[model samples]
Target: MPPPPQKEPPRSFTARWAALKNIPPFLVMVWRAAPHLTIATMVLRAIGAFVPVAILWIAKLILDEVVRLAALPDTPDGLAGWWHSGLADHLITLVALELGIGIASDIIGRLLRLVDSLLQERLVIDLSMRLMDHAAALDLEDFEDAGFQDKLERARRQAAGRMSLMGTIFEQLQDSLTIATLGAGLIVYNPWLILILLVGLIPAFLAEAHFNARSYNLDFRRTAERRETDYLRQTAASAETAKEIKIFDLHRFLSGRYLDLSRKFYAEARRIAQARAAWGALFSALGSLAYYAAYAWIVVQTLTGDLSIGDLTFLAGSFMRVKGIIERLLSSFGSTAAQALYLEDLFDFFREVPEIASRPDAIPVPRPIRQGFVFENVGFRYPNTEKWAVRGLSFTLHAGETLALVGENGAGKTTLVKLLARLYDPDEGRILLDGRDLRDYDLDDLRAAIGVIFQDFVRYAMTAADNIAVGRIEAREDRGRIEAAAHSALADQVIARLPAGYDQMVGKRFVQGVDLSGGEWQKLAIARAYMRDAQVLILDEPTAALDARSEFEVFQRFRELMAGRTAVLISHRFSSVRMADRILVLHLGRIEAQGTHVELLDQPGRYRELFELQAAGYR
Candidate 1:
């Protein structure tokens, strides 16, 4: 049965306030990430903030002087007359000052835009790097969790989208200062006008906050669906799945699913958008009414001789400027609150501490392994599931012994390998190396000491050399080692045939990439194990894709290659299993039998029966 879809728990008022608190720390992170650019942006914005108020106040003075000069007697059109009147000098000075302010404002705005773009780019890169580093530190089990995938998806979006939040915040800061300056001028004329403007803006702020929260909630709830849609889109169109999609005629099926899921999201978003627009228009009209009311009051005061024409012009302009700024600031604050909620995803991901991390005093794995692994009553169940993948399993793989594990599909062969690799820890018991718990050793060192290549190995979208180099990434530059490993895995012949030899791109994702046949790709993956050259080696059906003769050739020299190393071979083919010093038959997560080929064949049990059944196929 398919698993039930995960649902998001509803957020509370306190939770939203908590999300809001993340904004300060987030901004601090951005500032630290790009200190020079951040500071420059703020400095430029500060200078630009007060320019509007200064220009409006200057214009009022200029107008008052014009009125004063117009009332004076006409003067002769000569330098002496103009100088004697002082009007030309005063007017020229005011006009030059206003023009200078306008030019400075234009220059400051362009500089701010340039700085913001650079800072956003730098911050996104820094954030992506940190995200990757932290993700790499998490356990394999964490990556397998569905909830964690949802969180990761959200965090990835934040890595790109946080720049919008940063821009909004900077804009709000500059707008606040402009509003304060304008508000002060309005207050000197009449305090009640500022109050009226704020009152009208309050409803719009509340509406914006309400809609933003609703939008975020919808996005949060639909994360799983969104991720599924992305998966379907990739599956339908990506190069990896393209051949199967075409052969199965899955394009229409996938397209229908995508449309259905997208339509649901679109409907929810459209409803919220319509409501926001309707309410936004109503509140905006209210604010407009307040502005005109204030304008009318100022005109009446001017006519009543209680205020001068300059005072009327200045007060009206200040009221309009202050109202617009407050509206914008309040609206921005709402959007900023919603953005803070998204920041929670990014920060929460970073906050997740890996449960499988090594201890501060973790011991280094013993080199040239003296004693091999021991599984003592080991048990494990996958997360969120009741069925134990492996339980009460006890076995010893002695040093220099080649053990083969034969089992039916889903009989826990891969699970055992994972336990040995410490990709997961057994729930009920312990895995020991050299009589010490596997957990006691430094994880990196422990993994480095074992070379494992599973049947379902990844074919990296890189050069063939780089693909093999992944097994011992530090030795990537050692061309001699790469060639040697390739030869050992019989992949050297494959590479030799390639147009670019070792440097040939092996996946279909990039330009000039040459796709390899399945068996040929398996050859390259097997080469990775050879590159590792660890003390313990595991080949988990690694030859499943090889041709019959190639498989036989690989096994013919397997013992010679693994002469001094302890190896575990998991395969269904009795030909490979019979080559082991001991064959272990697994059934229902437990060891069913252990013996050499002849001994197991004589027992007349499942192993013998399976061997005869397989042998009959070729007859």
Candidate 2:
């Protein structure tokens, strides 16, 4: 799937088969899905092979009768004898047989094609469904990497075209089989003629091989360009880009860019088309010359009476039927092999390296969680970063506690919260849950047991209640819980103010939806986070967008609303930080001081200095 500047795959016999072997499973998978249709196509082809022989046989009969009548003497009885004895009737019968064979061949061919189309459609549908299912199953982290995305894009692209390639391959197989059978019939009549036809095809076969190689090489080299073209199309056509495009009045701008890439694609295709046209013309002429040579030799033998007209006709018929079969078989062989490598790319994704691999199976219970979740000796650096974002950090909270993480920007507060929420597993040390390692629980279970209200929470372009309902997908429609959660977070007022209340949509991007103010959205996010009814909740600046009154009111009811829950608060607001039962002041990725707000205010530390600075501003 990685489209890049590249050379050709091996065009030799051995390499072609090797490539075919690489994707045997995919070929086998499709083959298995429609075995009856496959077998029927092959059988139809085998039957159609005899149609050419029937025509040849009939032609020879007609030729023999005409020759007999021409050889008659000039006497009255001799002239009329051949005509009277049903010689014309015999010729008419031959003509009728030829026409019948032609009609039967056409019918069978159409039927086979119809079956091929249906079979390919079914297989493609299954392939696309499986790919979508697998993509959804992959962990959230894999989507972050760039290399993975390239392969995924390629896989998706190929899936659409793969069905067509596969069907063509099967069709080619049928063509080859039919040609071979007809060739065998020709051998029984005149073996030398088959050799002459094969010799005539050698130049064409070689030329086609060269062209196919060049075509694939061109495709391999322009992968990145193709991706850029896809991006350009999306930018030009998508609704998301419509606003900017209309504001800038940039129709020509996008159209010109699209045309530029399209012309480049067209230029490459034109080059290949021209080469094929020239080669095809040359081969066609060669084939015509070869056929005339064979025809002349057959006529000469017929004149000398050394060969029957029947044998000559059969030779001519089979010669044309079999010439391109070898090329087709070779092309199909190549395609079947290349499909293997694509399937390999798809299967490789299933091999996962879990982000957290060393945890025990037994999860520790929070039975009471009186001395709430604790972070002890916890240190974490991002996967490829040199510096720790949060290092050797330690803090503790009790149930019903709202402890604020106070720090300057980039002082590791958000990183600490993410670590506690287990969005990431610490590179060193562990997160202790009620004096035990947090890694014991199943990853899904652990994540489901907590709620997070991010400052940058997504504003869904869906109905207001559905946005909150996404919190617990398995739960029944609990209108009561949904309403209560909204009321507590002060989002009920936002909904009530809307024309349609809870059923109203919340974004302009979707139908019948209106965008909300920053403060309204903040309250919605908070309500959504607490909607799941989890035991522990982490709010990373949940009220940052709210007005002074909303912020004060939420914090005032914070204790009553969050009772019996272990809640951790993150904020830059001095008033909110001062009210936490315990305040942990962080500096340079570690806790510099921890105490109640008044106790921290008494100390000459990072917290006290920040508090004094804020107090002076207020005065």
TM-score of each: 0.95, 0.73
Whole-model lDDT per candidate = 0.89, 0.72
The TM-score obtained by model 1 is: 0.95
Score residue 478 of candidate 2 by CA lDDT. Answer: 87
Clashing pairs in 1: none
Task: Please write out the lDDT profile of model 1 over residues 1-619, one tens digit for every residue.
Answer: 2444664533775666568888888889888889999999999999989998999999898888877776778855777887777767887799899999999999999999999999999889889999999999898888999989998999999898777999899999999989888888888888999888888899999889888888889999999999999999889889989888999999999999999999999999999999999999999999889888888999999999998877878888888788778888999898898899888888888998988878898999887788888999999988878898889899899999999999899889999999999889889999999999999999888888999989989989999999999989999999999999899888999999999999999888999999998989988888898889889999999899988999987776676778989999999999888888998898888889889999999897889999999999999
Supply candidate 1's per-residue lDDT for 533: 88
Candidate 1 — which residues are off by over 4 angstroms? 1-14, 76-86
lDDT tens readout by residue for model 2, 82-104? 45776567766777877888899
lDDT score at residue 327, model 1, on the 0-100 scale: 86
Estimate candidate 2's alpha-carbon lDDT, on a 0 to 1 scale: 0.72
Clashing pairs in 2: 19-337, 20-337, 22-340, 23-340
Give the per-residue Cα lDDT of candidate 1 at 249.
Answer: 96
